[model samples]
Target: MRSLMLASLLTLSAAPALALAQPGKDCHLPGTEESLRCLRLAVPLDHHAPGAALSLHVTVAPALRESARRDPLFLLAGGPGEAGSDLVPLLNTTFRKVRATRDIVLIDQRGTGLSGKLDCKPGKNAETATEDELLAETRACIKGLNKRFNLYTTEQAARDIEVVRAALGYGRINVWGGSYGSRLAQAYSRLYPGSVRSLVLDGVAAPDQVVPAGAHDAQAALDALLKQCADDTVCAAAFPALRSEFDALAARLAKSPQSLTLPDPRTAETTKVEMTSMRFIGTVHNILYSQADSRRLPFLIHSAYQDRWQPFIARSNVSRDFSSEGGPAMPLHLAVVCAEDFPRLTPELLAEDTKGSFLGAPQIMRIGKMCETMSVPAVPYKEPAVIEAPVLLMSGALDPVTPPRRAEAARKYMKNAQHLIVKNGGHIVSPLGCMPRLLRTFLDQPGAPLKAECLNEIPAPTFQLNSAGPQP
Candidate 1:
């Protein structure tokens, strides 16, 4: 689910067929009412390839009922590594109101899904691998994929969307992007202003703002945990020195890491997770994505300090699993972020984002290092052509990444926008709270008046930090 909709289509061709009586490939998608169909217009691997053409699959689940169809809403999936077309099941309910008016469109991105995915799993999953086995694995994966793979850049993807827009014959469409998809939405708005009518960016990672780096975001979970403890009579009285306790836990692990043997999902074998400050920080980092898990951060650390390893072990791996489908998504992620976000990083620029952010820096640095070797021709970061469009930006106050401050920072660039700060809501808010209803209303009006009260429906913060578990 690397958020690669054009991963399949764009890598192949750019020559539109003008209407080739439907190509032969079957575009089957379950749980929808329409038949899936596909056709490829050969696109060059290098845009320089003038005549070479490749066909990519483009499938759609037309509006279930003609009575309830509105202009389509294009779903832009997250995961600088997730597949846009593969998110249908995850979104049907959240967008039900909007769906009553239009079809939900899904497109497999270039070099993703069936469009020639960049998945490399056999190496990491094998039972025979030793402690030092990844180098060969990485080598094999690289050589194997150098074959038919083409541009994995967002610029290539933008062009692919133009082809799909023309083929489908839609003059304007509503776009909804979550997390990294939000980045794509911004890019699209800049590149193809005429194509987008309305936009919904959840977990807003705006184009102008620098993505935060370090453990400061994770530190927010610890802060959330402290507040939760203080609010609860039992917790406040029981763990009064929560901050000291957490700091001590980190110090202890940094000095003496526990060798933990846990069940491995890859092969159902026992694997060792040696505790470290970085691992601990990363564990806290995962819970920041959702509110439910962030609550568990306190309990996880509290348990870890008492020498009960289970809780900490569990929380450690959540972000990794959330980021991947138990496979190799890191490389493609590098291709995108290395190109779009942090390329040509100045030391001062990196420091600016990391300042006071405990959890943000590590993640940002991790991305930066990974991106160093895989840099592509950079695309110019452009501002949205029209800030006139009513935009709704959502953020969780306690969210580790894309926190309220980050959301507010993005708001400054918008000429007209509503900034909804959910007291304790985590990263993803579109599918929850008053967001669904507000979104429905927004789309219903098209380019109409304002409605600020709907945001009132969001539940107030009753902050809690439960123990998060090891990630996948």
Candidate 2:
């Protein structure tokens, strides 16, 4: 009886033939099978104003076998600004077993990817910009955007997912969302629970988690890196006063910005770049995303303190994202962050959250203020999603961004779920050792115990004692 009801819900009164978007030979990831289909969906930019529409980019990689399951799996990307379809190659590779039976779907959300991407270029001298100067740039960004910025909220994105699901004629979907994508997955489940068959949240971000509060998590990750260096005999011996050295370097940079010719890692051409406290912190935050990257921190910090700028600059350049159009759309990031998280962050909240943290709250608080100034409406806060569908929650034990606590908090609301913590992992937990098999097992049999003991085999990143990195 339940199955029949679900089928009825999935097969909603069909959309008009004229409204149905068509699939054609479009985007494909490198090494993806030529058989994959690409689609361009036209969803409303503002649901209230049906006349205003936006074109969203989507790609579907069908099941490998002829006898495939009817239900498909939708993969959501992180970064409120991240292109959802970017995960296609990774999904195609990592979830190959699941793809043998289930089609994998990817939808670039309304404001990201080819879906009317909202790229904004802030002033070039952002590292030295005053609060007023930054605000002026933000206003200029708002003036430059062509679309209705207000409609790009998370709730609206959730609605867009439903439209895509209905357009493609999927009766049910299993969702896997990482980082910020996890939050969107929950929103979709809350709004359309019946459409979801199962849920997997990697780097789970609970609904109540204000975006700026993540500063604390980043600080903690840096602290963990410091502590690890302290505990490692080789590392401690190499840099006995690591923390003090870092403090001195930060203080020095804060007082006087250093300008150097940075050798482009890709091209040997030297480029002049300025290093300030803000720039250093920003670079550090990006590096902390992966344990492999964090392994370079101790060495990089020691080098920086000694005024050896080449290695530090080269390492910093590794995280740079260059695009034909500025970068991943910042307007989309602003739209989502302002509407969802920024409104809740008060001055008191900032003080309380950032206290004792090495990374100060200035950058995030400034963003929060930007959102406030732009007058982005707040989506009513809700309790964590109470999902009836079986869920798999994953987190990296060492993740500085979305820590294990987030998964633990989200686990409470899921009726049937399992939480897995990768001991040596960073922000992304699923891609680590033995985790792919565990994910496959969960998809094959939701609520079943995973044979994931192999996760223990993965070890912490070997600390680099010198320029040679970890010796074989």
> Using Cα atoms with residue i matched to residue i, what is each candidate's TM-score against the true structure?
0.80, 0.89
* Worst 10-residue lDDT window, candidate 2: 1-10
Q: Per-model C-alpha lDDT, please?
A: 0.60, 0.76
Model 2 Cα RMSD, Å? 4.2
Query: For candidate 2, lDDT tens digit of each residue in 1-472?
Result: 1112232333224542213465445455645656567767677777666666678777777777878787787888888888766676776567777878888888888878777787665456453354466567776767766556788988888888888777777777899999999999988998899999889899999777887777788888888889999998888999899999988988887788787666655567776667766667767888888988898888889988988877777765554321114346677887888888887887888888788776677656657655654577787787765899999999887787789998888878889988888888898877777787777788888878777788889888788878888735
Candidate 2 lDDT score relative to the true structure? 0.76
* TM-score, model 1 to reference: 0.80
Across 3-79, the per-residue lDDT of candidate 1 in tens digits comes to 12332333223324322213334555644444544444444444444455444455555554667444577777776
TM-score, candidate number 2: 0.89
Q: Identify the runs in model 1 with alpha carbons over 4 angstroms from their true place.
A: 1-57, 68-70, 122-144, 147-150, 212-218, 237-239, 255-257, 261-271, 317-328, 355-357, 360-363, 380-388, 412-415, 449-472
What stretches of model 2 exceed 4 Å from their correct place? Answer: 1-19, 30-35, 121-139, 259-272, 318-327, 372-374
